[model samples]
Target: MTNVVTCFLRHRTAVLLGRRSDAVGTYTGRWAGISGYVEGDPADAERDARREVREETGRTDATLVRAGDPVDIEDDGREWTVHPFLFEVDSREVTPNEEIAVHEWVSPPAIRERETVPGLWAVYAAVAPTVETVASDDTHGAAWISVRALEVLRDRAAVADDEAAVASVARALRDARPSMAAVANRVNRVMSGGDRTPGTVRDRAAAAAEAALDADDAAAATAAERCGVSVVTLSQSGTVRAALDRARPAVLIGESRPAREGTDVAASLADAELDVTLTTEAALPAELAARAPDSVLVGADAVLADGSVVNKVGTRGLALAAAREDVPVYVVAAAAKVRPDEAVHGETGDTAALYDGAAPVSVANPIFDRTPADLVTGVVTERGVLDTEGIRAVAAEHRERAEWDGGLEGAGTVSG
Candidate 1:
């Protein structure tokens, strides 16, 4: 059995296909989605799909929409298992490598008219739902997703209120993205509302979720009020953006590597017509030394009971640097981001995101890191700026309530 990966790089409504060159092995001169053999780990096949697309097409901005289950096909007595992937790209510009003579972006329906590799269209059909899921996720951040999840529960409540059904939805939302503390806290809030009447429960949960967003805005505004002329931040955060919008200070952003979310942040601020300086992550300290911004502001993925802020991978470094420079580091987030329990720093994705397999290499791509409470000047929440004591009190209250609501029996523990 031979394992291979086939990637469908999509731009808007069209899918890109390359006409295989005569110099390439088998299926020469035939049209196919970017294809390659699975290397190293089978689990890394999706990563391989992305790498192949980059190598073959020179497009680095494609977002992986979905990776469907592999489909097996018999061709010339050899069994080929094709791993299919769908990526949404912004541009349609194609720069072909030696393996591909030329490329074309064709509509889905028109794909059948062209002479192509077998089962090419079938692969797309299998993964259509996956693309739809990516497209449908309106909330790009954990905070937004948490609110949306609560909204879903409220809608489900209007129908029939079953404990199993509610739990099922809660579990799916919680498990959908485990590392987001806001997701856990928000879901726990709704689940804690108990299996009361679906309407009451739904109303309470929906209200709570909406309140969280409002608090987020308030917290960001409060944090922004304390900032100086310029601020340096890493990663792309809705809370940070909100604060920046309010503060309207000169901003320096690190083009966060791997994901490059900071680039998004920079573009957004630039569009707002704010004075923004975009730089590489490595150059942050030099920028800090030269500019000396009033404060380093960031958003939290989870605000732990000890008051430590868990955020994007580079956040800890930014906080530490701010400490040395005597610049206060503030985390702006809604109270919903606070978790009663210890933070969970989830594992990141494949190493292929960092390197091509041309040479033997090992890569560590952790998505989040925790900044010690001591380094944090303050945690700006909807309730107000929380010192360590204030944070502990808030966390204790939440835990006590969660214990009662989550059916933890006598388990009501909060560590300061």
Candidate 2:
């Protein structure tokens, strides 16, 4: 069987699609991913995939998200096996080679509407996050996981017209990150709040992803307005990053441990023209006493019913430090982050991530901690600073939407 690699280059919410030129050997004038024949070791398909992206799109920096298993297809008197790769790029700019006549970045689900080679959607299915991937992901925040959840719905919608897949994917996504209000809240919104057959859910999922991104950006803008000139923060939250980029305040940050995400956060703000100080997660009291900031700003994994914030493990200490220093604490998060749940789910990190040494010390690496609402001065969202009552009102609305059953029950796996 002949081997080839199809690389899907993705930006923020959309993916790159190109129309093949007449000069191309096969499927000329049809839309396809950046692709080329795998001329070397099949195991080097990833190397070949990146090379192909560089050749076709002139993007040498495309980061691979996942590589899918080979898909066999019989087409045009040839036996073909296609290798799939998905990549994320920071910029949307591309300079296509002779292979493509025109290129456009479109939602992955929109591929369903395009005329293309056989198994195009199937190729995407391999590289994209499955229900299992979304369920087991422990490295990202709620907002990021929520987008991947919508992407799961998007891919399922692209593959079939089965409403069962929609409900199944939605239910799976809600449970994937139980502590994440955004994942469940947003998925439930699409499943119940929208016209959600498989065909329709694709567009709705795409639109909802866009809305979530916008809400985060708007929420960041609101928080930026409230940020004091001196701020103490932790963790690498996209919403926090956006707000800090806007505020450019003096920052005293702690390493959000088990992962030194705070270092990355500081590096990300290198161009923001802000003064920064980085300390260990355990040095909260010393750091706060040494450099008392005006506010302790953080991003939430989930905002509980009473406005309590669930965030990185170091956040409770940070908030307590801020309180002792008589500084106010502000939480920046999208409105969807407010969940109906009153109790925070404890998620422990991998023991290997904490300690793999021969010592018999048991490691309990709780990934997050809750900061009481009484200690929080304000909860900033896209709607501006919400009072305790405002936060509770939003949580109640989500509680109403929490029930996964809109009307369809017994939405098991898709069966023929």
Candidate 3:
């Protein structure tokens, strides 16, 4: 049996694909990812994958995101096994070696159209997100999940006939993460729009994905205006990191418990040259009182019509601490995060995450919590600082988007 490794280098929404040269390859002129034979112990498959990426692309700065189980396939009567790995490369620049005759970065789904090596799409599928993977992801933020939701909608839109299957996908995405209102809102905007044909749904989903990404950047920019000289925050929001990058504030971060996501965020911010202080969730109140930062800038998973914010479990406590210290708390998120009502169903994590020991005591680990509106000083969005009234107004607009609900009222309008 032949053993090989396939590496997929992704930059943002696109993945790198190389066209094979005519010199020495069996699949000459065929589109493929960076791949090579796997040698040594099977556990060293990732090591070999990275080596191939470095050798083929002439770059050594790729970071591994995920790896898939080895896949078995038969190509032209040759039995083989493929180990797949996905990496995130910061830059699109690739100095292709002789193995690749030409290289181009493109959206992942576009790879299916070209004539390629056997099982290339299947290999790619092993490492990419499916509707199930997107629904189950717990480490990413709401904005990130929302964009992925749009991706799920777009990728699955054209896979069926009645397009009712696509509508079901949209609903599944909407309910995937109950705490992530941004995902539901973005999907609602795309599905509620006129025309529900597969083509229209796919195009609309693509457009919504772009707009959601842009809205995140714009919201970050708006939040940067109020970031102040000193700020305290918790959890890990890509938008919050972007805002911090723009302002360069002296930051204090609390390690969001269970997952301790803020510890990772602190390292990233510090790497970006920002002065950062890391603290524990239990000691955050003391740190806030002693340091007295100018603002508590946090990110939101959802903003309710009454102006309350839903975020990571520690966020409410952070806001409460900030309130007591006379520090203003600013919630930064896109306006689309605001929902018409406070329909909440927060997910709980594995009890093993909190207590995996042989203790008689029980453990509860809720993944999120809602912070009261009164505790938040203001909500900053892509549009600007929104007052309570402004938030409610946006909610009212979202309320009108219920035209597509229940039994697929607009399911018939799907794209062809």
Candidate 4:
């Protein structure tokens, strides 16, 4: 199979190249992008890209920008698909990875003169304009301008016109708001319910439902139409699961382990005629990786104050792998997933014990695992896709709101 290469170029320059190792391959000793094979596991791609980048440049702090489509190339009878990505880093800090015999930052004109690998040049040409636009915008004293550049590339590649694209972006933004809000409300309800507060389970469920439906039918329909892929959710939390279901993606439920709560989700989703995949946790990563899914939708058991997330143990590996691969990973839990008290206590737990009755064997199980905020591309709540800072702000807001409402009286507390 042709490997997928993440072509990392200098932010505004032509492309970054690295000398290949002595191993046999196309363009050996010639410069190449940060490349790797597309693994059956979605996490492999992301991991490979990061590894390659570090390997090629010896920099750990590089922030990668998602570039456009994959470009196909063939060398010595072996074909490869190159996925272009851009990153801006302090050039002074670059150190060549051991595999790299040499490195150079070549300009577009210089790129033309080199015995550049075939297919790669075209890919670079396609993405060069976008990178240049971003660079120019940055030089002109513009506010953070990466997204606008991405918008440009997205527009150029789009088959639809401006209006369609705008509408699509609008609908996604619109749907995300209420979905996140529903998540927040559900969490609040659960916390409140545990304390025997005024709200009942039905009330919380209703609040969640309302958040899911806040957008008009037309907007919701548009979003569903625009999103190209189906997302199966594996969560036991009702409010969260329901919120995800109402988002209109084709969702399937895996029988959640231990309690087998996923059975309930599967039955419900099946009744709705949604294509459901019922499987155990061990099978989830392989299943998802095999499908080469667009994204993975799951909930968090807890999110630390520092923005690290704690979800089910199985979820951590799945998420890390997904993040490693180029696939976008989203944690669709509500603001309630944020554990306000985690700061006072360090966050660490045994996750192996969630399974039933193997008491004779020592099983250390903690209900959650920490997922660094960076690993998460976005947090989809009834509110929307919140960045790391946005998530922190929202979590703080919820804490304040809960305290003001006397909503924290009897809640269980755990320190991070």
TM-score of each: 0.64, 0.89, 0.91, 0.41
TM-score of structure candidate 2: 0.89
Instruction: Put down candidate 3 lDDT per residue, 205-237, tens digits, no spaces.
Output: 887887888899999998998989999999889
Candidates 1 and 2 compared: the better one by lDDT is 2
Residues 187-271 of candidate 4: C-alpha lDDT, one tens digit per residue:
3433333432222322333333333333222222322332336664564543444444465456544565555667777776777
lDDT of 2 by residue, 189-245 (tens): 787664667878887888888899889989999998877788888887889888888
Q: Which 10 successive residues of model 2 have the least lDDT summed?
A: 407-416
Steric clash pairs (candidate 2): none
Model 4 vs. true fold: TM: 0.41
* Residue ranges of candidate 4 with Cα displaced over 4 Å: 1-227, 243-253, 341-360, 402-416
lDDT of 3: 0.85
Return the clash pairs for model 3, or none. Answer: 196-413, 196-414, 196-415, 197-413, 197-414, 197-415, 198-415, 198-416
Q: In angstroms, how far off is 188's CA in candidate 1?
A: 1.3
The TM-score ranking, best first, is 3, 2, 1, 4
Least lDDT summed over 10 consecutive residues: which range in candidate 3?
A: 407-416
Root-mean-square deviation of candidate 4: 22.0
Count of clashing residue pairs in every prediction: 0, 0, 8, 26
* Candidate 3 to truth, TM: 0.91
**Between candidates 2 and 4, the lDDT winner:** 2
Q: Candidate 1's residue-wise lDDT over 235-282, tens digit each?
A: 877778989999899999998776787888899899999999999878
